[model samples]
Target: MSVSSLALAQTLLNGALLGCLFGSIALGLSVKWGHLGVADFFHLSLTLLGAYLTYSLVTELLWDPFLTLAVTVPAFFVVGVGVQYLFHLIDAQPFTTLLITFALFIVTESVVSMIWSPDLLNLRPLLADGFTTSIRLPDPLPRLAVQPIDLVALVCAALMVGLATYALRSTRAGRAVQAMRQDAAIAETLGVRVLPLTLAVSGLAAATAAVAGMVVSLRMPLTPTLPLQWIGVVVVATMLGGLGRPLGALVAAVVLMMIQNAWSLWFPPQWAPAVTFGVLFLFLALQPLTRLARERITSGRTA
Candidate 1:
């Protein structure tokens, strides 16, 4: 229970909390891009919008962090719907959707700069006063301190992911959405409304993004350029997590964060992201080989 050990433990806890926040944002992207066959390249813009809007409402109207959700969640959902409708109108191919959404990301970032003037903004912590508490460690050890707000955020993210997973598994609508993701034509023939289902899924994804954005705003400073940073991390998380699995996304976020943090401690800051990307590349290269091996084993068993 040395002071250095205590410090390292606290840092790990903090990293886990931040990792949850990353997963929260990635969850929506996983659903949209992984499940629904949407490119959803603008997820970062949606997050930045939520963060910026939360900051504005909290600062101007004296809204609480929770209350800001009333404004942000619905607004982002509507935006999601509108964006989907626009995409439908364009009738873009999958790669085209990626290009289109990336373009939208640029436009949204520009809009954010125009409205917020590229300034950094942060919301007041929701539980500013009672957020941090200390607990005594054993004798000859430094006391441990925890931030309740960070813990709360982590718990909330876990709950949201659990609820979403349950909904997808247990509800008729959720099952229908899943079916559509696999085969839209077949699902449509089976009485699923593909258009409405896509809209609902997109809205849900955007709502989750809004929640993540608000939490991020409370925890860190926001800027117009922040969305680009989130996009890069989220893309990596989504890929490493196997695309559609929320749990996988959570695990990937933690792994990536740990790698980055551990590397940064040992090497220069510039090398951290490179190290992380290298690890991700290795994972990506192995995925298809692993899948092929599984498929061959299954076929041999059948034979």
Candidate 2:
């Protein structure tokens, strides 16, 4: 390949890896919003919480960033369960639930700002550093080197998504949860424990957020405001990916990231977010028509 072509290819690879992390973030939101029918506006808050907690622990106790997950994952899971219970008690209207969680997002962001400020905090042991230090890709791409840590993070994300998909497809609990999404009352009548199942799903969502946070920290600097960015991108991914499918989330993320990277490389940096939103708009415009055609085809098949 020519130099420019090689560079673009390398950039795309990096983008895909980053996209996997983004997809993982969306998985949690998809479960809460798509499957449970909960408006989990605060899903990104758990990610920010994990990021800041990891930062604090590493700074204070000198723990490894990977090791911090041992604490943050379970802690966030508990927090998620508590949040779900609170939502249940309020029996909130959809808008009210959305507003409450939006407010919670603001509160969490404010707290993060208070504790860590808006300053960018870079985690030590960045996988990039090691890649820059000792490794080089054989490709003729200028300044492109694959890092071991990057590979590790990408593999972990892929594995997590795979396991989540398998669980959703193969497990009894997974079937019950899927049934709940389709018809909550019917599922409850069939011996599904609604409350506990919801709690478990919520906890699982939080744990996913935690894992995403860890991967993100390894790859990029953490900022108090970063979670806000995640909320938007993840919401887009979830909606475009059909919400409950982990594999769909992964594909959506890769597509979005490729679009963003290609746009920014060939065009202006400021246009990247606009292009991402444009892709989302296109997807929204097409989805209903796609659904209608599918339904018509099914009707014809049955006829």
Candidate 3:
């Protein structure tokens, strides 16, 4: 197939927008995994729940879709706290939280399936056609363009990253959360109140998930279980971005999307995933080895 320059530009733009969406979806995962030290399998389910809530309220009650965040975020925040407390009650090890969260994921998925049905669900924005409007730049390819919705998603990604970065860096609670991330027992010894911090972090992550789900629903049609597709995005972007760093995830997402789209252009779409994962595995594998080598070199020099 002959690829037009305009078409390629459009493709790149789509990738950029998708990267933002994926980053936002993965932000909660990064938080819970990096800081809380919990294998939060239910993170995507929280996002899907947010979308379903927004769709139901906006469609049935005629409320503004974004306005639904007021409801979804807080509710999910409480849900996060409750789930965290349940984990605490079970005295589950950090790794074992993976199994607990998986159970939660299954339950949330079933609830969504029951309430929203197994069929496709979508949110209708007020400016549906307006979002589709693309701009043309004067040049060799006048039609090399992008939709406003993509830009909106990019902006939202920026805001989410910035907010998360600031929260983790500036606030006392956030600092305690970070402390716990580094070492839960050590943080507790320092009076960080590990459980409370865990609950707070969990709640904030869930609220972020709600925002991500809302942004996602705004951009495309969705299904109750579509959040599952986000697993790769969450894992790859979070690992690429660096654990516990929202800013890293944002930049990584953009880079990942750019590379993935470029690879797709020169190869079969199926091979693109192989390339994407191959790169991720190589990157992940090298990280620890490089760190170990650097530490050994430092020790030798000191000796």
Candidate 4:
């Protein structure tokens, strides 16, 4: 393959694969903001927390960081439940909740800095070293390169998607969660255990964040502040993907990453934040018209 062709192929493949990371990163925020109606500005902090916890445990106990999920997931679950209860107690408006979460994030970030100091923490998991795999193409195609860490992340993301689908579509508790998401009063009137279900969903969200962070940490260095950038990526993805639809969010995440990959060719990767935000701005600007068109189409179909 020609240089340009190979580069294009790599670009497309990475964009798509990288989106699994993106979608997973946003899963926690998606559940909270998209499903639970909590626009949690500090959702990214959960990822940071997950990364820090895994790193701390691995360093302290000499265990595979991957093995740390047994601890991280449960710890974050409890944290989420506690946070959700606080939100309920305050009966915070959306904007206020955003502020509250952001404040909590600042506090958490400070604690992390105090413990870990101001340094970029990167790890080369024993599992990821020399973990490259290549597949030969049959005649008209170029060989493709793959990484184990990325594969692990992709598999994890796919599993999360499956679990999310089953929970939202096939379970009674999931239905009640969705019902509450759409209208809390109506869901409660329908005998949905709104409080318990909300706590469960919030806990699920935090667990997803932990998984996302653990995967990303395997491939890169982490820091207390690193999740700040992730916030933009995941939030843009959540909105683009369809706030309340997990599968839709994954598809949208992939599409957005594809566009960002294209943008990267023109500019440095650092501009990714700008690219994502720009795409989100355009999407939001057009959302009202899109919603109206959809409503009209629905009415037409029914008529």
Candidate 5:
């Protein structure tokens, strides 16, 4: 299985592009988990729903795929806010939120399956007529083909991360979000508008999911169960990157995608998932040791 240099480069490029979309999908989950302490597993399902919606809009309505974002983002934002309100109404704990959202995930998956009929859907046909022109690399990198939608997804993912970072760092609402994450009761006592901030962040996170889903529709075929494959890797990436850290999530996802691509070069495609969960298990196994080492070092310094 000798691979050419050009082939390897192209593989890596595709992996990176896909990783960017993965980062986009994970961003909303990371934000909600980090800030709101709600492990909204259903975020992935929402993303799939967004993809299905994008497919219908593009193929049936003859709209540009990217144009669907204008509709999905705001609609999903409202959905996110409503979901958050449900959490609040129930006063759900972290574990409870997980169960509730997982239930929602199942329901969403079922609904999408019912509506979309478990068929594999994509925007490729709609994009075939001059919409998705591929770009060629120049000189030393000639023959490396870059799909337009792949590039678009990469750019959109980066932009979403940047926007989320800016919102978190530069705005009053962001500071409120940070404070609330640290301690909701304390933040509330300190005059931070925790409720409104929670709703806003949740909505923003859902909006990110919508963008991610729209990108996914442009880049790959859609199915109701698509989220199952993504949920594990994205969740691992989100956790390893730290909750609410959009940039960290993006970097982790890209690296993971690269590793998976490299692994696929030598191994079977079915074995690729081993790479994702293997990294996850390795990280989880190391966490205790890492924490203990830090604790011992702190005690030694105190001595």
Candidate 6:
């Protein structure tokens, strides 16, 4: 069976929107692991909690969905800082950080399950007719469906990535973050308050996760185990783009997600996941050769 051009365009559009959501989801992990050297797997758990909280507020308290960010963002920022402080207390090594965060992820998941009962909750009821509202492309192009929530996720992703890129490039704290990444001892010697900077970054990372979570609830349902499903793609995007590179992660996620979505159009749905990991594997396989080529180029220049 042949697919229509319009169908393909619609698929691509959905992929792009979902890609932004996934990219935003991975940002917290990217920032924490990339800059601070803390893997912080609990970041996803915090997102799940945020999504559930948003659902509760929208359903129980009759608050607007977007307004939920006002609560989740600050709350999760504090949670992120507290978790970072615990890491500081332990002098968390790479392996230990991973293990500790994994444990914390489990604990947080348990808390959410107990509170929310592992149910699939969403803001659909609160959204009413707004959920189905779509933007139609003008004539000369096939009509493509776009949801308000999708635009919300895309905007949030762009803002988070842009703000992060700007902060890292234009702000003093960003330079200190870069310095710490290069050498914490040197940055500290240069009078950078390394500890406070890390706490602040951690808080920001958690805030992004909260924003991501609220965006997610606007689009999808929340379940206690949802993070498990997300962890793979998020990690792939994070590693593919490298840690601390939010913009890179977003680009990687969008590309990977689009490819995966395209694959589903022609191939079995079961094989769709292979498209994602296969791309990652291909990149990993090429990375060493790319590194070697760069080294040779540098050597030739020196010669």
Please give the range of 10 consecutive residues that has the lowest summed lDDT in model 3.
122-131
Q: What would the per-residue lDDT of candidate 3 be over residues 1-303, giving only the tens digit for each residue?
A: 678776677778678788898888778888888887776879888888877787778788988767888899899899889988988899878778998888888898889888788987666445457766776656876767766767778887889889889989998888888788778789899998988878888888888889887777777777867866667667788888888888888777877787788778877877665665787989978989999999999999999
Model with the higher lDDT, candidate 2 or 3: 3
Candidates' TM-scores?
0.89, 0.90, 0.88, 0.90, 0.94, 0.96
Clashes of 5: 0
TM-score of 2: 0.90
Best of the two (1, 3) by lDDT: 3
| Clash counts for all predictions | 0, 0, 0, 1, 0, 0
For residues 1-303, could you state the per-residue lDDT of candidate 4 as single tens digits? 234767767787778777888788777777788778887766688888788877777777877877899998998899899999998999878888888898998998998899888698866644434544444445666466656667777898899977897888889888887888889999899899888888999988888888987877776787788867667777888887777677777777888888888777767878877988998899889989999999999999999
lDDT of each: 0.78, 0.80, 0.81, 0.80, 0.88, 0.88
Off by over 4 Å in 3: 1-6, 124-128, 136-142, 292-303
The TM-score between candidate 6 and the true structure equals: 0.96
RMSD of each: 3.2, 2.8, 2.8, 2.7, 1.9, 1.4
By how many angstroms RMSD does model 3 differ from the true structure?
Answer: 2.8
What's the TM for model 5?
Answer: 0.94
**lDDT (tens digit, per residue) of candidate 1 on 1-303:** 234665566666666777788888888888888777776878878888887888788888877777989888888889888877777788767788888888988999999999999877656543356543534445654565546656666876797788777877789998997898889899999899998888888888888888988887777788888876666567788888877777778778877876776555556778766776788788879989999999999999999
Residue 77, candidate 3: C-alpha displacement in angstroms: 0.7
- Tens-place lDDT per residue, model 2, 154-245, is 78668878888998999999999899989989999999999999899989888888877777766678887887666656778888888788
Error of 6 at 179 (Å): 0.4
Q: Pairs clashing in candidate 5?
A: none
